[model samples]
Target: MDIMDIARRKERPAHRVFSAGFYGGSWDHDVRSVLGKAPRGGADVGEVLSTIAAVEPHDTEAWPTAWIALGDRVGAVAARAAERGHRVSAARAHLRAANYLAVAVNALAGRTDAEDRLQAVFRRHRAEWDGFTAQSGWDVRVLDLPYGDGTMPGLLFRPDAAGSPRPTLVMVNGSDGSISGLWCEGAEGALERGYNVLLFDGPGQQSMLLDQGVVFRPDWEAVLTPVVDVLLGRDDTDPAAVVAYGISQGGYWLPRALAFEHRFAAAAVDGGVVDVSRSWWAHIPDSLRKAYDKGEKEKFDRDMALGFKLPGGKAAERTWAFRARPYGTRGYAETLDAVSAYSLTDALCARIETPLFVAAPHNEEFFPGQSQELAAAVPGAEPVEFTAAEGADRHCQPLARELTEQRVFDWMDERLGR
Candidate 1:
């Protein structure tokens, strides 16, 4: 039976957190992550909803405080469990604490002294996660990849059954996700399938952007080439069956990398993005669009700055401020230039010789129609779609992750003979 034909929820709950606007990316994602982690003792759904009820939409200041408080409470539980030598209980609590702290850190508006507490708290919880994983007997190791001048932090997870070198999955994160977060996103599923999983933070992702000060670059191939080289050099990886998966903005990055780096057996994207600037431009008001079209660049910039300062523009302010930091741009105008340059030309897509799997969710808001457009551009690209009817319609299939992983790995298994 066709997956899209399955019936699912048609409407979003009206009172749901951040249902009305684009605040701190997506509040629905925050809520979903919280609820999703409940199975792992990461959250209490009722308590989370109660906390959500206290904060107004787009309230970044209040958002972090509420989540962090809950995270701290969970951290205490983890500490007590650790003292009692309850390894399983401690690990579960630690993982949940780390998840909550991640959401708080991610919601931060910009890089400032005010964000230091949130970042520090997140770091502490992440450490707790590391300690828990070490005690839990999971075949996971923290490693740093050599990059230009500095190293990119990563985690390598080997399946428990170890004999012959297995098909390894190298996963690259999107614009805002952490290496730890990607585990929940797909690494856990990949490991369960007996594939060694490597989750890395490239330029503009987590530590690289926040700590290393490595800004985003349009030519993602430059960043990924070194990653591929390092992973292939590892003994546990099967050179002939290695596959790369890119999520969120990585959808664009992975495809761009595959165009030039042909060592990979295959590449897959959770969502495809052809041109980021075009999508950003679409979100701009028509008045600003007219100014840009009329060649009044300075006027357009001024109006954009004014828009953020106006009433009820806090969400816009927070979003742009967070985006600009990754590019090290002084302001939104320069950020736009950086984003505009990030486009996968049809010529470039046609150069890719590797098998490509493109997953397109029907209800994607950020980059609608992009997956199909990319599929059409790339020769023999296998384009698949997740529909609202199947309840996997949102970006990256956050709610239907198991189904997403199943479909993606099934495709990879077939192509790579795993």
Candidate 2:
């Protein structure tokens, strides 16, 4: 089934925690993300609310500054707690600080000094994340999984340090998701359920994009195959029970990879995505789309350039830059053209033999109804729906991590017979 065949939702009023127009829907969703983590000590409700209150909606500078300040403050608290030998308290605080710092890093996008600020804030986020994992007392092992010409950085977390084979869940992050965000998404829950969790920064993700300048590739099988190789080499990973779980944009990458690499016992995407370019296309005008279709790259670029000079065009241009940077493309037409390659065909979907689960959530802001389309195209794929009634809708059920984890991990457990 083609993604276009699925019906798209009309604009309708939905519940929101905040409605700051300048910051956009992504800002509100990011806020809910931290708050949702409070249950698992990834954040504090009071701290997140207080930080949000300090920022002025219209002041773009205020956004990153406030978050950086909050991150600094919490980071210091974590340091102090660690000094006092309060390991658990220190670990939780470190996670919160890391998450806040990541928020700041994200807010730096589109700024004149975005690259500098991103590098600075992202380093702090990475430090705090490292501190949390080291102090949390979990059985965590740092890994260097081999990739094309380099190695992808990863962390493997087990229930204990005792070397014993166990069911493992490999967690793949979405575009622009921080390592700390992965903890709230599924890593923490997986550990609690006696599942070994592996988290990594693949191409165009965090360290790879920022530090190594590695861009995203559509053939994600090239990424996951190496990950599987590393997992199978570990004495602590169960060869028969290794599974996969991905969220957000990973919804596309995981399925794309599984179509070629079939070693996973089971796999679940918080939502399924068939055509990743649809999200990019939604923002583009039909005129430009037509130009691109006709291979008129120069005309497409010229029209886009003119569009950015109109009222509110600067902001649009900034957004385009932020989204396009990871694609390793500078030209407007080139980036869209690159992203359009990230779609799955019926033949590719048919190649997937692994047990697949797809989440179809209400009000999926990006790639609406793509999950249904993906499930329909893949034979024997299971599709699960999350509704606002369950407080588990939107892109990744950001505000309902517990519910999302429960349903997803439960399916995984059943599939792995654990």
Candidate 3:
């Protein structure tokens, strides 16, 4: 390619909040995600900015430590508020504390003591989340939805205790999102629109993975079917208006599930994903990919082990380990093969009869163009574009939650005749 060719292909930053690096760009997005929750009481802008100011750039340890400190302080304030009979203040503070601690949980990914720290911080975060749910002044039901001889943890939030049937919204989380994140993503907005909201931890999600040792599975229909069954059994749910929405990795799971489980009235994905493995394969070297493709698992594993020991490879190795854990595989080749099975085939897309909404955001960092591919493959599916001009570019529109939610729910309302 010539210089002019390269220049023509170059693009500008979507939203330049920070420079490029793990602690810079990635952390900036994470901070924006938390701040986006401020409108829904899941976060406090001042508290979030103050927490960011205390962290040192590129210091992995400092990232989690600072967030944890903020969470602890906020949690204490929440406890004091509750003691003083300020339920609304306590609920808001607890929600923010839960979100702050969730940030810490994500930062522990590449740490030496990640497993231990993850367990401790996750439990604390869940506690704060529970505290918020109890005091949020909503009619919330803590549920144990049946799934394959076990139960999936879930929360069903209703705007009131009128016991009348209402339109319902099932919110699915991404690979590593916290329960509080569901509120920021859709639950709070759904509630405001008078829709009953259901949030749960499927296999490989928060409670399922951390507490029950359940890992991710390619056939997500098995996971979502049980959720639909539970929703249908509730008298408070409008069977004709039960819809689903998913974000991030859920962009793949929900579509895959809709192919078989056709109970949903409508569905939406914040950035569609045609193949979950594409993101994983993007980081693997071509030589390693060749070995894996050739079924040389032993050779690939040996080469990967050596590569991890090279200078500057430790961080990458740690990131791989973190991402691979949900696949329930320790071997690099095995994890890659497992993730490869998550692709959506043309046949699968053709089987989906539900009305679907796909968010094709510009500058999608992970699954670029996959949203368009998914829309083309799925007959009658609507693909909406969220561009950089509206500050709603990038994977999932982390900083543009309100705009994303508005478009998605509006489409859903039109489809469900709400």
What would the per-residue lDDT of candidate 3 be over residues 223-250, giving only the tens digit for each residue? 8998999889989999999999989889
Query: TM-score for every candidate vs. truth?
Result: 0.89, 0.94, 0.94
lDDT of 2 by residue, 1-418 (tens): 2232122111212333322111344676778777878878888989888887776444567878889999999999999999999999899999999999988887786565677878888899999999999899999888999999889999999999887999999998998789898998889899999999999999999899989999999899999999999899988989999999988899999999999999999999989999999998898899889999999999999999999999878767877787787889988888987998999999999999999999999988898999999999998999999988888887888778889888899999999888
Give one digit per residue, the lDDT tens place, for model 1 in 265-293. Answer: 98899989898787678768988888877
Query: If both were scored by lDDT, which would come out higher, candidate 1 or candidate 3?
Result: 3
- How many clashes in each candidate? 0, 0, 0
The deviation in Å at residue 164 for candidate 3 is 0.6
Off by over 4 Å in 2: 1-23
TM-score (C-alpha, index-matched) for candidate 3: 0.94
Every model: Cα RMSD to truth: 5.7, 5.6, 4.5
Candidate 3 lDDT (Cα, 0 to 1): 0.87
lDDT over C-alpha atoms for residue 112 of model 2: 53
